[model samples]
Target: MKLPDPPTEKSFPSPLHHPRTATMIGRWLGIAVVICFLTGLFSHFQQQTPSWLDIPTRPASLYRVTQGLHVLTGTVSVPLLLAKLWTVYPKLFAKLPWPPSRKALGTVLERLSILVLVAAMALELFIGFLNTLQWYPWPFPFKETHYALAWIIIGALLVHLAVKLPLITAHWRATPADRTPIATHPESLPPAITGLTRRGLFRTVVGAGTLVGIASIGQSVPAFGPIAVLAPRRPNVGPQGLPVNRTAKDAGVTAVDADWRFTVQGPQELSYSLEELRALPQSRSNLPIACVEGWSQGARWEGIRVRDLLELCGAPKGARLRVVSMEKGGFYATSELPPQFASDPLTLLALKLNGDDLDLDHGFPARIIAPNRPGVLQTKWVHRLEVLA
Candidate 1:
């Protein structure tokens, strides 16, 4: 015999209908997307302006990390976002027009805003992924398109958030509470519905895992080709054949020896001499350093990769790597390199920037050149490397 029809109207929803961990993740992901978009806009502008504009030049490493994290977060959020939209799809049909007695103008505007956000998010993430893999499918400059659409997306997001404020708050409040559970019904099925079961969980896990796996492999994958969608115009010639500072008297600075000492002591402590570092097997790489600040510079770097150095020092794994400036408290920064990058030969503790010796302003004796990373992670004037595991 068939079971009685599931309750259509109940005080509360079933576990499937109720907001679950995935929905919560989606809400946070939405918030994070907003923040990432804002920061990205700021970064885009900062990179576009010249050095004379007084905008702090973001280190190449910083650009890489922020943009990478932004992309990573977006990638991982995809499944959660889809699941959330699926669960809430029914709400779209509820006839709760704003100012119920008034015209449907507000409803139209709300619906339009939702459409923009959804479309913009999909386009941005998809285009962004393609750009990362160095593939430009469209003729238009991705940077220009991305910049123009960002404004639209942000505006749409604000309007959507404003419209949903009340419902969102109510949902959050009810989500955590225990009430009379309702039974599921066929009529409650959402469009493109997928059961919130093992299959759904497996899909999310696999999707997220694939993204992380690709990012990890990206460190050594060279032929990924030039997506160059957002890349500023490439320089025609190399280095302008600039002269190097040879003599201490001519350069007005004393050149330090390879025997020079380096220390890394903030939140942790460690030290390495130039010789000890050089004793490690040397690695050489020629990679383009792409700055989010809109300038791209290419150089041939030579030195021990940070990974080898870390291994040599027996630094504990999973520690946050902090590099201290050698130029008498000049500059310092921190980074968290994933295992793949940390171990990649291309990620060098560069003793030389370009073919010539390192300049004082350019991290004198040594700095780092992390592949596909923004300049910030490539800490300059690196005297000390601390691992705060």
Candidate 2:
């Protein structure tokens, strides 16, 4: 049987499929992407801190805020992305100019970049949202793949921006299509079938982005919890009134043995039984447990300071430290603390959380609670510390 002719651009004649609409939606999507990228970079460095990087320990909730924004922007980008795709959908059916002129060759490259951008962004948003739910149905390692996909998406996005910059500039501001009365302005006129104007489409897309943001932001902002119908986590709903991504059971940790001893190896060695740990001069920090999964909550943590512990172990000032956790099978069972974090007065070997002993899932015996650190790097169920510098 013969195949029917492919659909042409004229087949989709919704007036909202014009350049101005695409530019408007693209602007919003672009902003969200930039914010998401920068926040993600901060989180990456916080988790895998390099010796050259010196992250501050003040603003104890810095990680919480940045990570919350990361998830928020990623969530908001979904609707904007869909709207942008819809605005430009008709272009996919357009015929490129024949004879391979320079302009036609440029069109081919632009469309190719756009295709890569859409595919990568679409997949990126899909996996990113699922990650917040702590789900990984895909076979690939989520962290590394997610990290790499971000760079690819950003590069593709830059190429897309470069290709579309002229069109974007032309329609960047209000024109007859945006401002003229719809009754008289043919450019903003409703189509014979769709009965929708450009502004109407803009309003609908903006409303979608706003609603999705409101619904998903509760995972990060407790005040929005009741309205966060789409949120995967309630910030205060998990063990010890905070969400836990990895549980003691999941980490193959059942309980702390009575013979458990916390140790530190440096210029001089020191060890403490759990009771001895409690007897040390205690300090309290009001901090938040901010995980990469986008849930966070403030809690009062009482514990010995890492700097104090280092001093007791005869560690020199400004030394790097390694925190070792008893967690059985996972990355982040042991994490490094750069000198800045190790020397922070607020960085703690926390024994108590929210005025009570830590629940097993929250890391019993001792865990690291450092300012401006990712929850995974909090190093739960910590048993030993080694001075590295």
Candidate 3:
């Protein structure tokens, strides 16, 4: 006996289900994906610091801008992704070829790619946004999984682009037919009745992306801080007027006693007491402590410049250094300072923040402050600087 045929889906007309619409929305979404991916790559490299990759130390604000853009672009893509999915919802119901032919197998693979792309991209944005809140409710390792999924999403996206390239090219630059009636039936709602033409739908999607961006971007953009209510953090709303990723107590760091000393190990191994450090000539730099969590705040920092200390210790002008922190049992307990960062005039062993002695949580006594470096690499509660080269 022959098996019965499967039931077919009833096709419904969605005014926004046109190829031109998907093309237009996809162009912007593609741009967002590229920005998010590249910025994410930069961030991963910053944390991993492969031997072959040479990260720059100039302008001191390069990392700040790239990371801020990374988060902002990722957040805004949420709306774009939703709109793109909505536009292509009809495709989910498109009939698959029967009898398991070669063409049918290819169709299955293409659909599989779309499934992977959507799932990975959606999860990526979700976890990334949650991470900025410092919340981890997932079972897997956040960093490793996030990194791996990024590659999977990109790969699936490439496959999807290859499948959709014909359609994208056909409608990418075509003029919208505003007067075209969507349906002839009297009861059927057309663009004129719904007041949602192709142009109107495109504008609506763009508006959604813009709104999400403006609402959340303030966490990274200082100008938008007051209105970044949608973001997980307020730049100046944390303890001592700046958000804390890790506390001294949590890092197992306790208050130092009178015997506590700060040292520079080089040709001349020099050590200084708290009072002696305070007596040394102090320099000031207005720098922002930008975190990977997507929050940042600008503060006035005063201390001996790293280059100055290197000079005092008889270290070479462009030597790299290993900055050691008092905090224990953390990946950031010590960080490497590249030659350019070590020599920057603005890079300081910050002893003061906002005109007051450093808060214990904020790396009191001394901390590294270099332009454009991540907060984690700033090496808070610093006790030693060893010239590496």
TM-score of each: 0.47, 0.94, 0.93
Worst 10 residues of 3 by lDDT: 177-186
Question: What C-alpha lDDT do the candidate models reach, one value each?
Answer: 0.56, 0.89, 0.86
* Candidate 2 per-residue lDDT over residues 1-389, each given as its tens digit: 99998899987755677899999899899999999999999998887767687799878899999999999999999999999998889899999889899999999988888888888899999999999877899999998888898999999998888877899999999776664223323475454343566777788889999999999888888999888899998988987898898899999999789999999999998988999999999999888999898888888999999999999888888899999999997888899998888988899999999999999999997899988888889999999999998
**Could you tell which candidate, 2 or 3, scores higher by lDDT?**
2
Write candidate 3's Cα lDDT for 102-179 as tens digits: 999999999999999999999999999999987889999888898899899889989999999999999878484743
Global CA lDDT of candidate 2, please?
Answer: 0.89
TM-score of candidate 2 relative to the true fold: 0.94
Rank the candidate models, highest lDDT first. Answer: 2, 3, 1
Q: What is the lDDT of residue 104 in candidate 3?
A: 99
Name the runs in model 3 displaced over 4 angstroms: 1-10, 178-190
Ranking by TM-score: 2, 3, 1
Stretches of candidate 1 off by over 4 Å are 1-26, 50-53, 57-60, 92-103, 173-389
Q: Is 2 or 3 the stronger prediction by TM-score?
A: 2
- Which pairs of residues collide in model 3? 60-371, 60-372
lDDT of 2 at 172: 97
Q: Tens digit of lDDT per residue, candidate 1, span 187-252? A: 766524533442344356556645553543232122221332232223222233212212223333
RMSD of 2: 2.7
